[model samples]
Each structure stands twice: as structure tokens, then as C-alpha cells.
Target chain A: MRVSVIATAGNIAGEALSNKSVVMFDILRASSTISTALANGCKEVIPVIDVEDAFALARQLPEGSFILGGERGAIKVTGFHLGNSPLEYTASVVKDKTVIISTTNGTKAIRYAAGENGRVFIGSLLNCSSVAKALADLSKDIVLVCAGTRGKFSLEDTLAAGLVIKDLLKFFNKNPWQAKTQEHNKFYLEETPIFNNDALILEDAAVAALRLAEYYWQSPIQGLLDSLHGQKLLQLGLAADLDYCSKLNHLTNVPVFFNDKIL
Target chain B: MRVSVIATAGNIAGEALSNKSVVMFDILRASSTISTALANGCKEVIPVIDVEDAFALARQLPEGSFILGGERGAIKVTGFHLGNSPLEYTASVVKDKTVIISTTNGTKAIRYAAGENGRVFIGSLLNCSSVAKALADLSKDIVLVCAGTRGKFSLEDTLAAGLVIKDLLKFFNKNPWQAKTQEHNKFYLEETPIFNNDALILEDAAVAALRLAEYYWQSPIQGLLDSLHGQKLLQLGLAADLDYCSKLNHLTNVPVFFNDKIL
Candidate 1:
């Protein structure tokens, strides 16, 4: 299995993720909210690219059966039933409802990754371990796609990717599997049991993500709080959302977005 | 002064580099070649977007007085006077002659940054400190643009940007200049003499670049030799170019690409 990471959706080529198991991360709220909403019993999430798409999709569903939810520029889109806050996605509000989401960055990333063949799993700190385990079980090369803010890098998404890659590395290292010699030799892990047991190739970005995760291992929450995106969220009075998204392994469900709906 | 780094030229928006002092880094060769050519007494270099542009520009110049040079896929373009290898731009061939270049990445970046107000300078390890000192003298907010290989991140260009930022930080710290409070506070340099002397702010990418530079400070040459781009160049029998580009402070000239020519 080869693991690679794309820092932002804009970095993704049209056919890069085809046939690869992809874990999409937008931890600053999209992934977190999706994971929370599904865990809270929301039926499914329909990610849309723009406010018009959300309204168009919601209009087709029966009134009150679906909710318009998302943010533009970090604030609730005008007339949206709920903002992109995970805490707002409670059982009472989103239960048994379909959420039509149109956020500034996250939904665009989902659309970008939905280009062709591949299972797109929404990941955040809430389901970091669960998503990692799922990827390991699939036993295919994986690409962690970060939904960076706009066309720029976002620290929160990258760190979330790091956390996922780190967890996946641990899972594969602990489980016995067939090893490929060239990949093992590149990492110089000849003596490591995991390398002997399984063949795993980590691209440079994946290795960098692991190193980044280790750098912030002592205080991942603080790392998020200190990020440029996190600071913007805090200024927008979304400190609670920031805190919620920082919790590692807080949820067990891995929300997979397939066929235009996150299940 | 605010310092920001763009990991790749593709990430730059049309207006992102407008009105900013842009330092373009293509450490694997283009920037290095331009800087070395100018230092070796080449009259000037015209950076164009395509081979046709190079030919068009050359036709307007005096016959036999200009040279068309550059690479298409790391190999010399057909019927060109020279390839992108800095060594090919020696004193005997390039000195006192106008050279038009169109490479895979660097020239595109120069054109991208040339959109509006602001000066563009070519940078590499050969003239890293020289470029940093020039920026300090300009006393303006700086944007370091890395001309990544293709549209993806090239480790060598990024690390070279890091080296330039590191040098600029040192220049500000060592010399007395007016300091901006917010920039100083963010860096937590409140008690430092440089903070008192000058105001400078680093964007997230700049901070990341500094950290990356520090991580590889011990052996920068090896870092370049091991980069994905460097490896590709080495495979193409361009080890000499890699070795030349890896040398720090070897040249004192700061080649500024202004008015469509590197002078």
C-alpha cells in the first residue's frame, strides 16, 4: 500500500484519485460537521458546490425532510437552516434529515475528489482512528485530500491529515501483511517487523505529514487553536466548533461520501 | 514588512503577487542559471512563456547577437543555442550576448509575477544571501514564489525559499531597522533587539519555510541532492547543475527580472 497526501483540493489533478481509496479531510468543520451529523442519526449529507446548488437540491425534497446547512466566508449562508458548526448538528435538528451543504472550501473539495472511481471517506479528528482503520482494512493505496482554505494551505486540514496518516501507519505496522522489498528498502526499515510483514510505500508528503503529527503530538488541540484558519474561526465566534473539531478519536463512525451523498 | 511564501507558482492567484516584491526561486536550475549568467557578464536574459515567444523575441533582436536557450522536458530544446544547465551559460558563450529562455516552470512564474506593480528577482542558493540583502534594502513586504516543477511542489525550490527567508530574518536581526509591533509580537520576539529595531511579519508559509530550513540546515546540499526534482535531474545526467545550485553564497549578484529582462 502506498500512502500520499495532497495539501489542498486545488493540488488534485482530475484523474489523480481514480481507483484509490481517498480520505477527505476538512477538520475546521466540514468533515467534523458531517461526521457529527451522521453520528447524530442524520440520514445523509448531499454536498453541493454553491448556495444555488444547495437551494436547488433542497427544493426537490419535501419541506422539513431536508435542511439547508453550510457557511460562506465562515458565517451561515443567508437562509441556511444551520451553519457549519458541528455542535449545531444535534439529534433534534438533523435527525432523519438530509443536509444540503455548501461551504466555501469543503464541498468544493468533495466535488473535486468525486471525479471518478474511488471511495471518498470524510475524515476529521472526531473519526480519525476509525477512518484510518477502514483504510487499512481496504488494504489499497490511499490518498488523504485536505480541503485547504481557498486555494491556499490550511494548517488545520493538514494536521488532521497528519493525524490520519500517523494512525494508518500505526495500524499497518502492528498488523502482519506481505512486504514489498523496494518500498521497504526506500524507508530503510529492513529490520522493522512491519516492513518484513507488509509492503508499504509512503510518499514524501505522507512522511512529512507523519513528522508534522509527531511535532504536534504533545498538544494537537493547541496546534489547531494556533493555526491561521483556527484563529479566523475563533474571531468569528466559532471557538466551540474549534474545540469540538480538535478532539481526537471522539467518534467511532467513518462517514463515507459516495454517489453524491455522505452515508 | 510581511513575508509570505507560495509553495508553487500554480497556487498564486492572478492578483496575489500584485504590488508585492516577488522573489522567484527555481533552485534546481532556472533561477540558478539566470543568476550565474548575469554574474558572468551576460548582457541580459529575456524570460518568455513558450518556445515560440523565445523565437519571436529573438527575431526582433540583431541576428548573431542573441542566443535562444532553455529546456522543454529537462533536455535542451531543438535548435537552441544552449540548455538550462548553468555551466552552459559560461563567460565565453553568454557574456555580452542577449539570451532568451523558456523553460518548463521558471519562466512561467516570472511571467505570473510580472502582472503588475512590484519588482521580480531571480533567486537560488548561489545568490540566496545576496537576494535577501537586496530585499532588506528594499524595506518592503516580500513574497517568495517557488517555481515548482510542473504545477506541483518541488522540494528544492521550497527549501531554497526557506533559505532566503532564513537569511532575511538574520539580516533584520543583525541590522537596526524600524520594527512593526504586530509582526514582532506574532513571532514572539518582544525581548529581542531586532524586534525593537525593525518590524517584520511572517505569513504561515514563511514560518513553515523557516522551520523547514532549520530542519535541514546541517546539510542543505544533501537535501537538494535528495529532492524529487534533483533526483530527476541527476537521472538526466545533470548532476553538475545540481552541485552548482546546491552551493550557498557562491555568487554575490542579485539578478532582478524587470521590464521583461533579467539584468
Candidate 2:
């Protein structure tokens, strides 16, 4: 399980992610919101980068069958049903409805990772362990993508990545570096990747993520609050959202992107 | 003072480094070698990106007065005076001599940083404390550029950057966030800028660096050895250079880049 972490989707080449299963994180809200909404029975999520695009997608969906979601500057976009807050994504609110969401950073990341036929899974503190377990089972090289704030590194997303990486480290302990051949073909489908002698190589960014998350091993809320985006949200009177986003392993289901929708 | 860390010089816009002081770190060997040479009484070090440029610069200087030093794939370039090994830069060999060095990543980063009229300094674990103190005293926004291995994030450089950031955190303890206006004018000159209420902000990448370094607070050598580049260097029979580069504050002299030369 060789892993490389990209701090932002803004700088990565789509082809680099072609052979890797990408774990997309936007913990200040995107990942957490996606996980919460889907877990609450939201049918599917169509992520688009621009607000106009989201509205177009929403309009195309059958009326009363879809909900407008996401935010701009941490506040709910005008005419949208909800903001990027996980607390608003309750069963009563999103049940059996499609969510056409657009966010500042999160959805943009999902779109980028989904490019070049990438297998994308959305992860956050909410489903940290579940995501790790899924990836360990998948047995392929991984790229943890943090959807940073306006192309800048964000602490919350990295922490979420680190949490998953920490789990992967423990699961693959003592494994030392050899690239897996026929790697991509057997990675995603029903076939399990078997290794005679495997190495769990972590590149620099991956190692950095693990180290930072380990430092905040016991207090994830502190780590989230320390992030710039988190601080902005807190100052905007969204402490409840921060508290919700910081929960560790609250969900056992890992959200995977498939055919333009996160299911 | 606000600080932003560029994980590598590869992705940054050179203008972003403008109006700020730049601390370049290529801890594998480039930075450590430069600081060692300067500390050992080398007259000045000229950093150029290409071997051809090093030779061209050498031709521009008097013979026997300067030496060519650098590496390609961690080995001494053909006919070059030395490889990228800090242990070889003893006072006997480099003392009072001008070194026109070209390194794969280090000099490339130096050239990029120097492009936008930025004040640049070279730092490594060897002069970590000195660089921190110099930046603290400078009282301006800083961009720590890590000359990562082939434009990928290198653990050793981030660790070195973290060490400097940790010091700044201590030096400006309890200071909160406020951007300095007329900032560029007040910075880099003899005129000291006074702040009524200043903020010591560490952007996300900067904070991540501090956390990772703090995790290895008591085991820097282990951090270096764990780094991918560090491991590669060790495999290439350069453990001594690794040991030399990992020494914290081994030299108090902070080498400053002035008029295309580090002195």
C-alpha cells in the first residue's frame, strides 16, 4: 500500500491519480456533509464546482426529488436548501432525495479526482476507520487528496487523511517497498490483490500527514479548530458544525464516487 | 508576522515570495553544504541551477580562487571538484575559496526565489536556530521554500522548516492575527516596523510542518532517516552526510544571499 498525499487538488495532474484509489477529504465540511447526507438516506450526490452548475443540475432533476445543497464562504448559498453543515443533513431533511451540491473546495476536489477514471472515496473524521478498512481491503496504491481552501493547504483535511493513514499503517505494519504489477486491473473489482512480498511505502506527504495526525491523536477537535478554515467557521458562529465535523469514526460506511454521483 | 510554507518550489508563483523573506531548505545536502562552506570561511557561494551555468560562472571568476561543487543523482558531476556531501566541505579545502555550486533542486529553488526581488537566506538543521532568530528579528512575513526532491515534498526539508516555525511560535507566543499594511516597505530595511497589536500566524502548511517536527522533537535523525530522500542518500553510502546535516544549530552563522552570492 504505497501512498502519496497531495495537499490540494489545484496542483495535481489528473493522470497521476489514474492508477491510484483516491480518498478525498474536505473535512471543514464537504466530506463530513457528504457522509452525513448519504448515511441519512440521501439517494446520491452530484458534485459540481460552480453555483450555476449546481442550479442547472438541480433544475434538471425531477421537482421535489432533489435538494440544493452546499455553501459559499461557510454560509448556505442563496436559494439552496442547506449550507455545508453536517447537522443540517439529517434524515428528515435529505431522506430519499438527490443532493446537487456545490462547495468552494470539496466538490471541486471530487470532480478532479473523478477525472482520468479514478476510483474516488470521500472520507472524513466521520468515517475515518471505515475508509481505511475499505482501502486496506482494496489493496492498491493510494493518493489522499485534501481539498484545500482556495488552493492553500487546510489543516482539517490533512488531519482526516492522517487518521486514515494511521489506520493503514497499523494494518500494514512490518510491510516494507515493491510496486504491485497488473496493479490497476485487479485493484477495484471483485478480485483481491495478493502479494508474495509487499511493501507499505509512504511518500513524504503521506508520512507528514501521519505524523501530524498522530500528534493530535487524542484530540481531533483541537486539530480542526486549529485549521484556518475551521477558525473562520468558528468565528462565523458555526461551532456546532465544527463539533459535528470532528467526530471520529462516527460512520462505518465509506462513500465512493461512481458515474458522476457519490453513493 | 505571518508565515507560509511552500512544500516545494515547484508549484509556487515567484511573485508570492515577493514582499517577504525566503528561507530555502534542501536538507539532503545542498543547504547543509552551503551553510557548512560559509561557516568554514568560504568567501561566498554562488548558486546556479545548471552545470553549464556553474561552469560559466566559474569561467567568469579567477582560477584557483573558486571551486565547482554540486551533484547529479547524488554523485559528483563529471570533472566536478566534489559531490553534494557536507562532510567533504572542510575548512582546509573550502576556506577563503569561492564555490560556484550547482545542485539539482537547491540552486533551482534559489533561482526561483531570487526572481521576484525577494530577500533570500539558506537554512538547514545545522543553522536552524539562527535562521529562526533572524526571521523573528526581521519581523516580516516569511515564505519557507523547501527544495524538495525533484519537486516532490521531502520530509527532511519540512522537518527543518518545522524546527524554524516552532521557534517562531515560541518567540511570538500569544500573539494573534493581523496583516501588516505598507508591509513590503517596512520589511528588509534598517527601519524597524512597530506593531501595536500583531499576529503571529502560521498558515496550514506551516502548522503541519510544526506538528510533524514536534512529533520528532527528540529524534531528528530518525525523522531524516525516515524521509525518502534520506533513505536514498543512506543507500548511496552517505550516512556521514546525513549525520552532518541532522546536527541542530551546529553553526550559528545564517548565510544570507546577497547579489547572487551567499555569504
Candidate 3:
């Protein structure tokens, strides 16, 4: 099975990944937030590219059945129920509501991939290992699509994509695409030495898992709450349940986005 | 002094380099070639944004007294006497010649900075240290304008800019603008370490400088010379001179472009 990791959806020259298994990542919170919302018993989360679509979706959902959430330039929209920060969501707020999200970069990237011809999965560092496991289990071609910042390659997004690549490498010898992507990642990783800069990789992972677990352990989504995307959620006051979501493998529920809905 | 580096010319939000010191880097041969042409006895090098403008400028020059040279996708213009590789402008070729040159990205960047304020010095790895010295001497304010890949930040250009920052730190404490630019570059430098892995610092500097020194050296611009941009140049048959232009600090000449000509 061939597996490839595209740096970003913007650079997809001429529909290259049309039929591949595509996992999209927006680790600075979009995918993580959606996963969190669904895990916390939200019926569904609809992503829109712009503010108007978000407003339109909010109007269509049954009255009092949904909450509008998302941000532009890291700030909440006026009068909206929420902004993009993941830390604000709690069981009291999202237990039975739907979420309408509109973001600057992530939603646009998601829409672009959804338009492509393939099975699509929402990805984030929070559930990166799980997504990699899912990719390996399928034993087919895959493309890790990073939702970079504003139509350009971003450092944070690329690092999360690297996490997926690192996990998938445990299961298979890298194909040419995988090799190039890995080489590309290895280049950057060597520069910062950020991951291994401090002691105890296990401790760091454990703490990250714990933080996520604290937020949404029982809600279903777990482990992702510790990712870079997850931290941003904490800032937004959206997912006060972030600590519960950090527990690694607590729910075993892998939320997969298919042709339309996520299951 | 406030010193800021524009990550890419595309991201220049306001006035570009007005009443300030700005260094422009098109390290993959354009600025390096221009530097060499000026240093090696060229009478003048006129940079035009489009090929038509170059032709127009050439026609205005005295008949048979000037030369036309440059590349579109790294290849020589049809029927032109020279290509962009700095090595092609040895004493026999460019000395005493007023050459008209245009390239895909660099010329556009130069033209883009044409009307803006401040002194503009063409930058390259070949003149990295000297450029730093020049900036230190000016000691007012500085902006490093990266001639990025098609108005987007590419690894090579940003890294070269970082190299400039690293050198500049030796002479002065980073001012507020330099601090911000450094912060921005830290992200890109950390993200593209593969381009610098295991390579000696001087070797890395020379990698982009050697383009002009290519005929002087026996090798070609080896090792991943075929990138999206590099391949464009190769397809135009401009690949052979890449090695010469990629060398570091080979041309101690710093061609200052202000008003219109390379001084």
C-alpha cells in the first residue's frame, strides 16, 4: 500500500491525491475542536469556509439545537456563542448541541479536501497516532493533508503531520513519497531539537495524555487534547474539558469523516 | 535602529524600505549574478520585470555596444548572448558591457522594490558577510527583503535571510524590528533544517555562491538541485551554471541599487 504525506492541500498539483485515503490535519485546533465537540455528545459539527455559510448553517439547524463557534485572526466573532479556543467547551455547554464552525484557514483546507475524490478523515496531533493506526489498518494508499496557515506552509501544521508520519513508519517501509516526506521532516526536526530538547519523552507524552484525558476522557475523544491544537482550545475558553480529552486511548472511538458525515 | 526582515516581498504590508537600509536576496543566482557583473567590470546591469521591457531597454542602448542576458525558467533567452549563471560573465564576457537582464522571480522582486524608498543592496550567500558589514556600517534601520519563490516564502530564501540575521547579531544587539524578524525566521529555519543538515556552515554558504565560480570549479550544482524552481531553470537548459552561482562569498562586490542602476 502506498502512503504519502502532502505538506499542504494548497500544493496538490493537479488533483494528485484524488483517490487516496486522505487524512486532513489542522492541529492548531479546527480538527481537534470538531473531534472534541462530537466526543462530548454534540450531535454534529458542520464546517464552513466563511462567516456567511456559518450564519446560514446556524439558521438551518433546529432553533436552540446548535451553537456557533470559530474565529478569525484568533478572536471570536461578535455575539457568537464561542470563539476557536478549545478550552471553553464543557459538558454543561455542548452536551446536546450541534456546532457550526467557520475559521480562516482550517475550514477552507477541509473544504478543499472534501471536494477531492477520496475518503477523507479529519486529523490532528491529538489523535495522530490513532489516525496513523487507522491508515495502517486499511493497508492502502494515504495522504496526510496539513491545513497550513493562510494558503502557505506553516510550521505547527507540518510538525503535526510529521507525528502521523512517524507513527505510520512503525508499521511499513516508507514508499518513495513517504521517504521524501520523512526526509523533509527530518530536516526541520534536526533544526529546532524541540521535541527532545527536554528530558523524558515518555513523561511529556504522559502529561499531554493526562491533560487531554482530564477534559474529555469519558466524552469519547481522548489524547488529542494535549496537542498544539488542543492548547489553543484551552485559550479560547471552548473546551474546559481539555484535560479529559488528553487521556490516550480512553474511548477507542475513532471519529472518521467520510463522504458527508463523521462517524 | 529598527531592523525588520520581510519574510517575503508578498507580505510587505506597507511601504517597502523607504528611508531605510534594505538588503534584497535572490540567492539562487539572480542577485549573485548581478553582484558578479558589477564586480567584474560590467559597465551597468539593468534589471527589468518583464522580458519585453528588457528587449525595449536593449533596443535603446547604443547598437552593438550592450549585451542582452537572462532566463525565464533558468534558461537563456532565445538568441541572447548570455544566461543568468554568474560564471558566464567572466572578464571576457561582461567586462565593459552594459547588460540587460531579467529573471523569473528576482527581477520581479527588484522591480517591485524599484519605487520604494531606502537604499537597496542586492544580497546573496556569496556576499553574506560583506552585506552584514555593510548593514552594520549603515547602522540606521534595515529590512531584508527575501525574493521568495513566486511571492511565497521558500526554504532556501528564508534560510539565507536567517544567515544574514545570525551574522548581523555579532555587530549589534538586535533592535525591535530585528527581534521581530528573527522571531519570524526562527519558525522557517526550524522548519527546513534538511537544507542545512551535516553541511559545514561555509559549505552551505558556498552552495549558492558557486554559481558564478562554476567554471572555476569542476563540479555541477549537485544534491537536490532539481526542485520545483530549480527544475524550471533546468528545463530551460540553465542547469549547468547553477553550481557556480551557489558558491559563498565568492564575489566580495556589493552592488547597491538605488534610483535605477547597480552602483
Candidate 4:
């Protein structure tokens, strides 16, 4: 399909991005943590834009079913059950719990993209393969929405998206037969220069992407607290959830949003 | 020197531009045209934000001595002296005249950076070497302000900034500078990776910048009308003066802006 990448949310909110299958990415922590929690065994990850909403959601959850997670500039929120570190999201800690996530950049991006018509998959390098596979199965036009820091593009986020684009290209090549056998291969691939780079054979490029992916797959949320931007969050005392956000496949399911709410 | 880049005016106002050595680039035309106009032998180029203000300035100027020029979306403004095209701004047409100029993105950027302190120079690849030398001589904190199309960072502006950064690194290598330059010297040089990359070396970069500079350097007012953003100004029917902007010299002159005026 026609896959247009808006470098920043601000670029589209007031200008373009309408009726697109938006894939929102905040690679440093938010998206990675969400993917990890869901994969490990978390029930649902509810992303809130503000701290008040996060606490409100945690309070309303059925007692032990929910865990408060997320960061404010990388530090854990006060009185919260966890911080933003993905390492803390272990099988023992979050085996079957709902997660309340709130961060400065990621949630706001989700809120913004929620206005569009197509499916919004929480994307990151950790879940790049699965997300791409899901998109291929759904086979619809996709937009890799990068949740840039504030209103600007971030190097980390853009690179992560490059990974997603890279993966989708690979998926298309490996599954030439899946389309003939399955019913979900209806989406058309849009030719773009961003897809031409041959990073698969390059040792450094492959290692870098895989390392970044593996690092976040388990301790995804924790990765955010350590980043240049994440440190700012930690200094702000939003560190509790940092540990909890690091686990991979903690929830074992992905959270999809459409029109601003969980779908 | 610290380099701050503002993607658009929508993110901040003139106050945000206040107190910095700003290099404003609306590369599609304003900076290019302004640089071009000065290079081609124009009087001082006056940049006005509003179209009505440009018209008012035009009406007040002495007749036959001035020309009104600018554009709106690649088209000429009605009731104006000329359209926004570098090819049209020849010295024969613009010599010894006061021209009222206006444009969409470029002039707005000029207004924004002009409101700040320190130096404010219109930048584009046409004057890449000149802009770099000027910034290096000043050696103060610098801000690369891109007058993004509408309010988003287009591919054109960032690449242009990378070009300026590329030149600064080269200039640094030749200069017998003092200590404490290591950190910034590397940073200034690092941006060159994108500029020097084989993938981006195209005539569009230099030609676009040169066209803008030539347009602005010619009939100072007509040059101002040569930006894509300038076209937006023309469409609104705002025309400005050319007599105020001066000619461009081979030895780059650092336009110092203090007290709301470029020196």
C-alpha cells in the first residue's frame, strides 16, 4: 500500500496524516516496554498521557490485576508499583497483570495517532518482526508513525523505524508463498528508497539492530531510562517502572488502538 | 558553539528566536534568493513578515526607484513587479532600484531570527562557504533556523544546514585555532557525514541555493519573492522593497544582528 512516513506527529496533526495505518514508535522505552509486557504475559497495557490518568487507571483496576508502570523523564512515578525499566517486567512480577503506562513522549504520540482511521500497532525494534507479520496478515496500507521527542524527530526513533521498514521488506521476500496460501496478503507494497539499503549482510548493521532489539525485548522499558532523553526522565524521579518495563513477552499479546481507544 | 535548530515558527514565536546568532534558511527560495539578490548587485534587502506591510513599504517608496517582487506557491502575486524565479532576477532588470519583497516561509524566518540578538544571516547552499566562514569568525553559539514549509522540516532545509556544517568543518581544519576547540570541532565536523555522502550530492542542492541567492541579490525586492515561502507571500498580494538590501561580497561578511537589526 501507500506507506508515507511522517517524521514527526506535529508534521501531520496540523498538516497531513489522515486515514493512514499509523504505526507509532517510541523506541527508547514506551513502545519497547509495551511490546515486552504484552509478550511476557501482561493482560493489557493502557497508555495514559498524564500522571493523573495513570494513577486513576491503576486505582480503578480490579485490585491485584493491575500494575502501575511508566516514567516521567525516565524516573519512576512516586507511589507507583514499578518504574520504566523493561528488566523489571519479569515473569514472576508481571505474569498476569494489567499495566498502566504514562510517559512524556510516547503516550502523547499514541493519543495523536489515535485520531486516524486505520489500525494503530504499538511498534518498536523489539516487536518489529511480529508487527510486520501482523501488518502483512492484515495487509493494509501502513504508516510508521515515529513518536519524536516533543514535536521533533529523534535519532533513535527514526533508526528504529528504519528497522521496521527493513523487516517488512524481509518479510515480503521470505513469505512469497504465504500470500498464495493465505487470504491476508491483499496489501500492496509501495516502493521507497528507504527500503533499498542492504543491511542484512552487513555485520555491524545486523548486529546493531538485533542487539537493540534483544536489549529491549526483555528489559524494553528500562532502556528508556538509560537513554540521553530517558536520563532526563529519571532525574525527574520517574524511575519505579523502569525495571518492570524490561521484560520480553511478559503479556504475550499486543495492544492495538483505533480512534483513541483500545481495539 | 552550540547549534539549536527550530523546525518551525509554529513551535515558538519571535521570543524563541530572541538572543541568538541565528542562520535562517528557507532554502526553497528566501535564503537562496536573498543571497542571489545580494550577489547580483542589489541595495539592502528588507525582510518584512506581513504582505500588507510589504505593500505599505512599497507605496511609501519613491516611484521608478523601487520594484515589488515575491511569490505564492511557485506563482507570482497579483499587482506585483515580478515573480519568484532566480532566472528572472538578472542585474539588468534589478540594478539601482528599491524593490519591495515578500515570501511565505523565508521572510517569516527572517522576521523571526531578526528579532533575536547576535548575528542573523540568510543561509542557503549557494553561499555555503560564505555562511560557514561567517559563523566560524563569530565563534559564538549558533542557531540554524529552518523556515520549514508551512511548519514542518522538509528534506531541503536540513540538507542545506548540513551543507553549512560541512563547510565549517573544512574551515576549521585550515585555521590555527586555540584549545577547547576539540569538542565542538568534532561536532561541527560530524554533521558533514550527511552532506558529504555520495547519495545526497546532487545539483538540486547547489542550484536551488544559488538560484535563491541570485534572485535575492538581483532586484533586491524581486530576489525576496523567489522563495517557495515567498510565493506564499506574493499570493497574499504583499510586495516589499529592494533598495534596503545590499550586494553580496566574495569575502563573506558576518551580518551581526543586535538590537533587532542585521549589521
- lDDT tens digits by residue: candidate 3, B1-263: 54455545655544646676777888676887898888889898888778888888888888877778888767788867888888887877788889888888887777565545735788876787688789878876667777867654433444455456555655654331221222222132223221122221112112212211221122213211312344345445544444455565677777887667776
lDDT of 4 by residue, B1-263 (tens): 44455655455556655554578766566666665555566665666666788789888878877667787765677887776554456677776665556887677677666664534787764565788787777776556777777665443455456456556656545221211133322132222222223222212122222222322222323322223333344445432311122122332533333343333
Cα lDDT over the full model 1: 0.76
Per residue, candidate 4 scores C-alpha lDDT tens digits across A1-263 of 44445556555563344654577888667787777776678767778888998887777778888888877756778877887766667777787887888877888888776664635778765666666667666656666677877665454455455455555556556321122232211121111112223331211122223223332334334334323354444445434433333333334344586544443
Q: Give the TM-score of candidate 2.
A: 0.90
Top-TM-score candidate index:
2
> Could you give the candidate ranking by TM-score, starting with the highest?
2, 1, 4, 3
Models 1 onward score TM values of 0.77, 0.90, 0.62, 0.66
lDDT of 1 by residue, B126-174 (tens): 8878988998888888899988777766667777787888888786663
Candidate 2 residue A178 C-alpha distance from true site, Å: 21
Model number with the top lDDT = 2
DockQ of each: 0.10, 0.28, 0.05, 0.04
- Over the stretch B1-263, how does candidate 2's per-residue lDDT look in tens digits? 78889888787786787778789898889999999999888999988888988898888888899889999989999978988898878899999999989888898888776657745889899998899999988888989988888878888899999998877766766322222222222121222222212567778888788877776656577667668887777667677777778888899999888688898
Q: Write the per-residue lDDT of candidate 3 for residues A105-126, one digit (tens) a residue.
A: 7777776666556357787656
Candidate scoring better on TM-score of 2 and 4: 2
The docking quality of candidate 4, as DockQ, is 0.04
How close to the true structure is residue A106 of candidate 2, measured as C-alpha lDDT? 89
What lDDT does the true structure give each of the candidates?
0.76, 0.80, 0.58, 0.54
